[model samples]
Target: MKKLEDSAKRGRPDIVHFALMEALSTPLFLGNKMRVYVHTINDRIIAISDNLRIPKSYFRFEGLMMNLFRDRSVKSDEGTVLMELADGTFTDLLGSIGAGKVIGLSTAGVRSTAEKVAGISRDVENCAFVVGGFPRGHFAQSTTRLLGPVYSISNVGLEAHVVIARLVYECEKLLQEGVDHEGDKERGKIGA
Candidate 1:
């Protein structure tokens, strides 16, 4: 909450907007399998998935988000709107999503080897890979408790956009190879 308040005070809500855009624009999301839940600073959870479109311009995105935050709803010609806003904490939102595992990305967490990280998308039928929306600082204690395993993609701290892009890219690659939780070896084998 302090991180979010700091960003807002600094007039840098664009950071959060771009983080969301990075997640939604990924091939994994484009394939219509992943969902995004944003726990805002004001204690509201904004759930967006499927049929979502983000503005290409940062300022435009900022404007849209500002309006949505004010109005709590905004419709688009593309039929994309703020899906739903629920009153809750981050844990409540996670519980509602019911992902099998919630992996949090943070520099403070253990460094994950490539093989271990590569299996993330296939390890569970439903998973939520959470990245902090605020510019800096760690997740709240309650939220951290809900995370299954916190992993760091890089030795040094990474920007949210970079982390999200790399993680989603890896997940998409594995998913494209037909790797799924059911362990269908035949599906991942090319020309089988």
Candidate 2:
């Protein structure tokens, strides 16, 4: 058997599973402002439903992924596509979304705080953040070609789950702030 470290093994689907869970649990997601797209090592993309209940158990999540690959999608009880395989390279997904700004998170990127990086969501149309799904190594050239801004949020390398959680938290906070700001504005108009 070829013994590769767990992270180095077969693109590490578990890492992607955990990262998706992190992002899915955020307020940014609950508020319906976030969408998830996964680009596979084999040049396919997976689009996750905003309301899909991601399995917490690694074994279950692995099974779900296998089923998705086999059937090309999973549907809700109502037959809505909860997850599906989509055509395209990572670049094609970007073009289809028309993301005004695309930022990639990497330890190799320019040092920046989560606050500044998360600000990409403000005053932007379809802002997208690229968090690596794989545990080790950097994004492939196909992905990097469309990754516009690259930011580093840590002094040391961190796991994909940690990065996804922290970034989603920051983005969620910004979304809340916008809501608060709008409410305050409406109150001022009423008082005027």
Candidate 3:
């Protein structure tokens, strides 16, 4: 994990676009690198994660409508926010960001195409996917419109990279521990 952080820092990560015009037909997006984009309709927030490793159980797109109504409640319309999960789960909260009292909703799920699936490759290590270029106030609509076409680009390339990075870090740690355990076992055998 430490080495990965160093590697990522040493090699500046690149930003890739997940355009809907091309994304709708494909299952993946930009090579193994991670990418984040806002929906055209409600660009209130941005979604990012290891698009592929994300189990369907953790994020679902099919039942989002019903779950939105059930699990979340408006704590304060003035500064209320709701967070939704892929598996029909959500939370409510409050906050203000100077633009006015606003609510935030969060969720994870699959990208809607196969091109996006291909986008989930094993290229980069760890990178941040940022959403930019939109004027203020029109973010939500832009995101909604983007999401409107494709069902969901569930584990896109950017997310795939994130998953790979995490897995590589964990695997490296486990390998080191395995080596230590083997040394201990050998030492015990010699003592016996």
Candidate 4:
């Protein structure tokens, strides 16, 4: 993988790892309020189920991904697919999820706040957000074409993990549940 340091071809699996750590453990994701998917540099999509816990270590995540690629999917002990892989473009992913609107977060896109974007999400059913997994540059032309509205959450370029953290926080705030399983006030996904 060191050889890919000089190449963009699968060069930043760690970026995806870190972003998953920020997202998968959040209340919004853990409470079945949201779903996550990774669109790789090679055009493969990995759909992550909310119940699956991501490894905090990069090496473990690397090993898990190796198995996932080899098997093309990961299943829980009870037989629920934890993570599933498929060959698809970004457009295909949005369509498969029945996304009403595909919003992209890119440094190259129009400027906006995370809350504003989350606010917009409440208006659209099954809204999806696209955050790049690479360390640098913008979304490819093909990916950008499928996005309904691209937004920049910062005045300066931000790392993918940062954008993911901020967006998740705002979404938790904007979409918090009125009552939880225990009938307590808990921040959660929109309409949960």
Per-residue lDDT of 1-192 in model 1, one digit per residue for the tens?
A: 347545533345677778878988887788887787778666788878576777879878878777777777767676566456668987788778887888888888889843466477586867788888766678878778989899888888888888878877777767766655335555664444
The full ranking of all candidates by TM-score, starting with the best, is: 2, 4, 1, 3
CA deviation > 4 Å runs, candidate 1: 1-11, 78-82, 113-115, 179-192
Q: Backbone clashes per model, in order?
A: 0, 0, 49, 0
Q: Model 1, poorest ten-residue lDDT window? A: 1-10
What is the RMSD of candidate 1? 4.0
lDDT of 2 by residue, 1-192 (tens): 137533442567878888888888777787788898888766789988887879899999998888898999998789988899977888788887899999999998999998889987787899999988775678877677788989999999999889888888888888778788888888895342
Q: Write down the lDDT of every candidate, Cα atoms only.
A: 0.75, 0.84, 0.30, 0.84
Candidate 1 vs 2: which has more TM-score: 2
Best by TM-score: 2
TM-score of 3: 0.19
Residue pairs clashing, model 4: none
- Which of the predicted structures, 1 or 3, would earn the higher lDDT when compared with the native? 1
- In model 2, the number of clashes is 0
Least accurate 10 contiguous residues by lDDT in model 2 = 1-10
- For model 3, the stretches where C-alpha displacement exceeds 4 angstroms are 1-31, 51-60, 64-192
RMSD for each of the candidates: 4.0, 2.7, 17.9, 5.0
